[model samples]
Target: MTAPLLEPPGGRPLRIGSRTSLLATVQARHVAELIHEYAPGVATEIVPIRVSADVWDGDLSRIGGKGAFSKEIDRALVAGEIDVAVHCMKDVPGDVPLAEGTAFGAYLERGDVHDVVVTRDGTPLADLPPGSVVGTGSVRRRAQLGMYRPDLRTERIRGNVDSRLARLNEDGSGYAALILARVGLDRIGETAQPQEVLPLEFHQADEGVVSMVPAVGAGVIGVQARQRDLAVMSLLGGLNHDQTARHILAERSMLHELRGHCNSPIAGYATTTADGAMSLHGMVFNRDGSELVRFHCSGSPDDPAALGSEVAAELLRLGARRLIDATGG
Candidate 1:
């Protein structure tokens, strides 16, 4: 038998907090829909909040690192301005602890985890002219690109997907291509063609085939609420996707163990099998992709964190710390 749905305090509509960006609002609405499905009669409201990362035109590291994206929303959550907060797991910094008094109540099912390339004319990455410039904000992506195409140069590009696409379309924009997460583009209704999807392995002229590892928590959405709020937690718990949650746990565990920061060129992906086993792949790279260390391992799904830590330990032993510290991450 299903349990009775707990009503919000005072019978008010449950308010969901999200960033002001169109993508953020869309994601928040998705969460609201999930809530509605879980409790047919429950009422929900979306609250758009502006975050520091959105307003700051300068480098994100200058403000408060990656937390700039979530701090304000977290503050609202802690202050009772909203009942729940939605976040893209990839944007959540792995090195730092989450906001005090708050914890993630659920992680939505994972989405397409592959990164895709968007070019002006749908050109394959390898066919691009030598010295052509690619734009991306991720150190991990930049480093991987360096490893893949030493002749190609990378410029830092920041903004939401639309703005980035606009930059790519601008007359003077030097970007020959922009690499983005496939899921983000799909969510925003900008699906990439099959040829544009970057393969997991690419042929590097001299180095043979190289693999592009995805960032930790790349394709997951996390729902957060105050830890002590039983009603909210109970409500949000129903939305958790067990397999996705396990993968996030393993990936995040590896990230936490590595002490990776926004500047850290770290990538990790975790997967679970139907047999209750899990595998994690972790990699760390230098700023320019001149150095890299990677490790992979399998373990019991019951202890995802342990598996993540094991991979992290292996990476550290292989001199991942030196590469991470060199970038001052």
Candidate 2:
């Protein structure tokens, strides 16, 4: 493995690799601001990297799923071209482990993790006209929405946040509602009021009970660095949020245990309880949401990985692997 320099050659600012999307640049700037706040006088520059997944024309699953978004940035890190890489945690796939010598060094504080329904003129999801079309790119969102509201049609929509919103805002766009991540909308300052902020907690609905379990590692920003870059990692450590790191670590561990792919509808979330115990919940669903295998476990905060693994094992025993195979997840 190539050992990255302790400092950039010629005293150049440390390069932080980020995706070229607007939302990604926003996240990159946020992290840069935090870095500047924590470690003053450390010159840093945001280096945008174009990822294949961002430019791919076909469905995400066919192009290698969410991991595709991070591969190039990770390559840049491994190649010593960048000191660190910033990524939306949800886009890092569970099946593909980080490259050797690279480690997740810090996690920003958690943000709003729930998905939301944004509609033209702000029509509530339930109140939308019957047979109305809803747009989203996530299979998990599609399955859940179908289960929650079978009367509505779920269609695949793709683009950066602004482009997707444009499609929704344009007159006669044919979409009654759009499912989007609340954090993404908030990050970009898009104030299209959410028709409904889907709750994570279970509740009774007209089409039976429903809950919106977030994608694993959702609402978190991950800072990755070369393991040997002690200087960079030390600087990043100052920006780490311990509580958020614990939660994301458990979530990622569960994802690794599940080995769930992008093609599968897998959701996992971890949080602390009132007494400070760490609890993890993992769910696996069939394509149509007809069958679900859900499991939960709690453990000491110090051993969050164990808690996540335990819950994942239980879900697997309940046929999670079967669903994954059936759906190529």
Best by lDDT: 1
Using all chains and alpha carbons, the TM-scores for the candidates as numbered come to 0.95, 0.94
Write down the worst ten-residue block by lDDT for model 2: 1-10
lDDT of 1 at 92: 99
Tens digit of per-residue lDDT, candidate 2, span 1-329? 22223466789888989999999999999988887777667778999999988787568887778988998998899998999999999999888879889988899999999998887676777677779999988878877776677778878888888888899888988988889899999999997555578888644346454467889988999999998888888878878899999998898888888888888888888999999999888888888666778888889999888888898889989999998888873
Summed over model 2, clashes come to 1
Model 1, 171: alpha-carbon shift in Å? Answer: 1.6
State candidate 2's TM-score.
0.94
Residues 115-211, model 1: lDDT tens digits: 8888878888878899999888888998988887888998888878878888998998888998888888888887644337766543453764434
Off by over 4 Å in 2: 1-6, 204-210
> Where is model 1 more than 4 Å wrong at Cα?
1-4, 192-195, 201-210, 274-276
